[model samples]
Target: MLMRIILTALPFLSLATASKDTCEWPSWQDALTTCHGPPSTYTVKASNGKGLGLFSAHDLDVGEIVMRETPPLKISPPEIVKGSGYPMPAVTKLVRKEFDTLSSAVQDEIMSLTYHITSSKEATMDKLGIIFRTNAYNSGKDIGLFPKIARINHSCRPNASYYWSDKLNKRIVYATRKIKKGEEVYVSYIPLLLTQEGRQKLLDRYGFKCSCDACAQERAAQDVSDERRTTIQKAFADFEPQLTLEPPRTKKARQQARKNAKASLQLTELVHQEGLADYFAKAYRVAAISHARVKDWKVAAIWANKGYELKYIEDPDSPYTMEMHNLTSNFIANWESELQVGQ
Candidate 1:
């Protein structure tokens, strides 16, 4: 299957990149160029010892789509996850079964990705199995393989981020901030809210130790980043439950909601200071919901605007984007009504 969309997008809010970016997919037009060279703001080139990476061929804005590619390969995730959440879902057989179903052109695209073959005493899978394990991106219902997206490489602090677009049936890479030409676009392959040590533990799955700018900070600075991220993680754990579309039914619940919202707003400022631009649109959306929960429509509108500005750039024409836009343009009427959830 093949699909191609132009290299363009909505306006940005200085939200995505940090003088960096940048990273994926397949179509007839895309089958191989993504692995070799693709015509867009980015291209695939050797990324030193890290293998081939997607590089920005020209300067890109905070809002630009570095690349939007329909996947050449898609596979279902195992009905059951193994060990907390990980590998070995009959990889040897799964890849062989699915691999035979692909078009030769798609097969070539699949082959272009780098892989790390593993062997158990009883079985050793083919290269495609290793490739599938290493590169699959989670899209709703099924995971997919976007060879170019796989090549962008990892960083503790990535300048760009990738989102699975169910609406477009493609993976979109959008700048998290302004990125320079020739800069290697990075995305966080591990949890960004973990400390360096914690992130490294997870990066083990990828078979490399990250030495991104965030990881290379001096001892004192690194400790500071670790603390910030740890706090962010804890705050998120405490705050996520408070995010709701329903109105509070009792005075105690209303007071608790306000307290949680305020705490979340404080966390937002901390994330921005830590240069986690990827967290902003979502944090802002949480802020909006909090304010609206208290009937503070004016402030809620302000927060929704911030979210809409960045989310619009990351995902345009999606239903969520439309909902975000409505929250920004008609906060009182739209969100106020939504607050009636469960009532």
Candidate 2:
């Protein structure tokens, strides 16, 4: 079945190459021209043997969606690794089937991606399996192969972050902080909270050394950041119990709530300074809720407003975005008048 698809598309392959302009080579970066909704402010360039990378063409603000793309071929993990069931799934077979169904142009684009040839004696399915494993993003229960999004390289302290939009059936990458013109925008491919050594181990699996700013930091600085990250992780975990308790009924419960909120707020601030922009909007929301839980509406309103602004950047038209907006507006409308009354 897979061979049939490849054979069918083989005839159209020549047309795919014939359509390319000099700028659009067989190279991976040139494939950006084939992606959906890529911002003009970014350009594709060589990344010192990392192949093609996305770079800011001009100054970009925080919360800006740098690029948004819907994957032409998205497959679930179970499909990729179908175990022995009624019918066992074959990873390579499934991938090849999907690849064949794509337009010749699209097939060419997918073929141009940066991937390792895993085995000298590997079959076509085996090679495609390695490519998909290397480049696919986790989309809930499914694994998605996004051509353009896959181009953005890894960084431990990434300036941009990507989010999957169920509604759009697309993945959006946004700048978490100000990105200067010509600066390379990166996303942390692994867990942000991992220590340098841990992050290195993960990067090794992808066949490259991560020289991102965070990973390149001096030992002393890295240790300090790691310690703070560890503290943030532990502190947030401790606060989870109190946060889960339904509105503190007794004095002890109330006290514990306040303590938990305070600790969370502090830890979140450190997280922001450590260049973890992905968590900033979340941290602000946590702070707002903490203050509001104690009837500190004025402070809550302030934090909620900030959270709303940041949330809007991260996800426009999202239910969570609306919730943040509602939180800020309601808190402000209710508290602003009261504070003025006393004044």
Candidate 3:
């Protein structure tokens, strides 16, 4: 378990107090104590203009669950649009009513969230709307406000991935790679497959420029990265034709399928080398299926195990996980026995 640190002792207090509604802000200790959820493996530290970000307190292995918390404040767009949905004022009133219902401590914490204000002189309802838009996570149909997890910053090439787990009834954050002590944990706010330019555009709505390695590369380097990603996209599209339920009957067709699979793996590797690790499991899955298509169960088993291990970290109960497990087991059982017979 990692220990929690107070925010007041850190640098976020100046901004927390800068608002005209400073009185509404949580007290020094309240601000410090508010974002501290149950301990697991991270501690909060000042991230300059990015505010406070979660940092690993120890060396964490790939696929390890780093943090888990059920959000304290959750609001839905439907709730705001319940009556006279067209009128912003009516929706604003609904939001205010909901905010007023929370305990003073919770309300203070909610108000303390980093948000862009349209009008500083705007109504509290309007401010509430801005807060909800800025901080809310779209949990399928409903948007949830998670003060604690909101502090986690964004990275296009994030080291951590987050997903909502129904079994745990919490939003779980897991390390996607080995994260060293003092490394800041991050999650992608948007899909990772987008080009750097497209990603920056999406993140613009959040009022911060992304400084991720993928985004900060020199123009020549960025062009190379983009070209690699484009090749990966084309290779995956071409490989789709080879994934038939029935394996190719002709030797020529089987050779073509293997060629396509190898091409896809080659392209995927180039993409991964560009610091986009999100494609790693997808590439391994393609390799597993490609090898399995040719009855090369030994190679298939190795790829399947790699893919399954990665998928299991994010979703242990996923159907994909079960499929991978069954495929790996079948390959090992069949191939190991055949090897023994040959020996």
Candidate 4:
């Protein structure tokens, strides 16, 4: 059985020195002890105009583990509060219930995370709720708050990526590309397979416009970025099209599988051109499965190894990485049998 790291309760100091009435500017240092991982490879400070942003302390190689943390605050989606008729409140009633359990200092820490409030009336009603809505990361069935990780800002072409790791019971951030020392660390807050305009609309909710590579392109370059992203979206549809349990016994069926394997390889190249480092694993998985469908075990296993390398860096303890690990390591025999058949 896989071991899970339980999130133990944090003992917070009293906020007797500050006003508990309203959330003031937050400092991630307030939750310092809760942070786990390497010794300060990042510096959290004010970004140009984007609030607080994290920066790499030294040159970081691709696949370096940037940071890791077990969220101090983790709870089920507040919408689970069933009796409400409305779709949901900004923070849901869970905010009040959870907030009351924390020390005044932690309560203030939660409140100081985000500035988004639907209205002053709502803020007065539940300030913690507003902050919760603004900063929570949707981790599977639950929502969690990782104060320091939240300091990493958004970029349409982010150099790093993060995901909640159920296997390790923590959140891990990894550099998807080489990052220069002192450069701001970024991760996409929205899906990146969208046109510049489409991404802007989604980012508006975060109260900032993205100026990453895709969004910062010149007019002509912007057109090309949109076209590339659009193509990627279309290509992904056939990335792993359905196949039968056994390799196509019919000539035409076998031809179709061959075409699929070829398309998967082509999409891999396109994804690289688009610079979606975080998506490299998915692209490789598609190729691995597609090649296996054609009974090309050698090529399929190679693709699986490629995916394992990247995912191992991105999320070492994630189920996806574990799957790749099994496919390439000790359990390769069983994995080969599982992929030995397809239409």
Largest lDDT belongs to which candidate?
A: 1
Best by TM-score, which number?
A: 2
- Give the per-residue lDDT digits (tens) of candidate 1, residues 1-343: 0001100122232222221132222122322112323347788888877878889877767766678777777777665665545455565466667778888988898898877544463245466777887888788788788877888888888889878767668787878987888998998887789999999999887778788899989999999999999998898787788777688999999898888778768888988888988888878887887887776765777787778777766665557667777776566455445555535
Model 3 agreement with the true structure over 1-343: per-residue lDDT tens digits: 0001212222222343243233232321121112334346788889856888989877877766678777666545544345644345654565677788889998888888888654545445466767776777766455567777888999877888877765555677778878988999988888766677877888887888888777788999888767776777777677676654367789998887778667656755776686565667777777877877777767777777777767665666668767776766676666666666787
Per-residue lDDT over 158-213 for candidate 2, one digit per residue giving the tens place of the 0 to 100 score:
89998787766888887888898899989888877767887788787687888888
> Can you list the residue pairs that collide in candidate 3?
none
Residue 136 lDDT in candidate 3: 73
Considering lDDT, which of the candidate structures 2 and 4 is the better prediction for this target?
2
Candidate 2 displacement at residue 307 in angstroms: 1.8
Worst lDDT run of 10 residues, candidate 4, spans 1-10
What is model 2's C-alpha RMSD? Answer: 14.2
TM-score of predicted structure 4: 0.77
lDDT of 4 by residue, 1-343 (tens): 0111100110111221132233231432222212344446799889887877899987777766678876777777644446752234545576567667778887666666765655557656555656666787877667877777888898888999987777556777878888988999999888888999999999887777787767888999889888888888887864545533356778998898899889888888988988988778888888877787786665676777778767755654468877775654422443445545431
Global CA lDDT computed for model 3: 0.68
Question: What's the true lDDT of residue 225 in model 4?
Answer: 82
Clashing pairs in 2: none
Models 1 onward score TM values of 0.75, 0.78, 0.77, 0.77
Q: How far does residue 57 in candidate 3 sit from its true spot (Å)?
A: 1.7
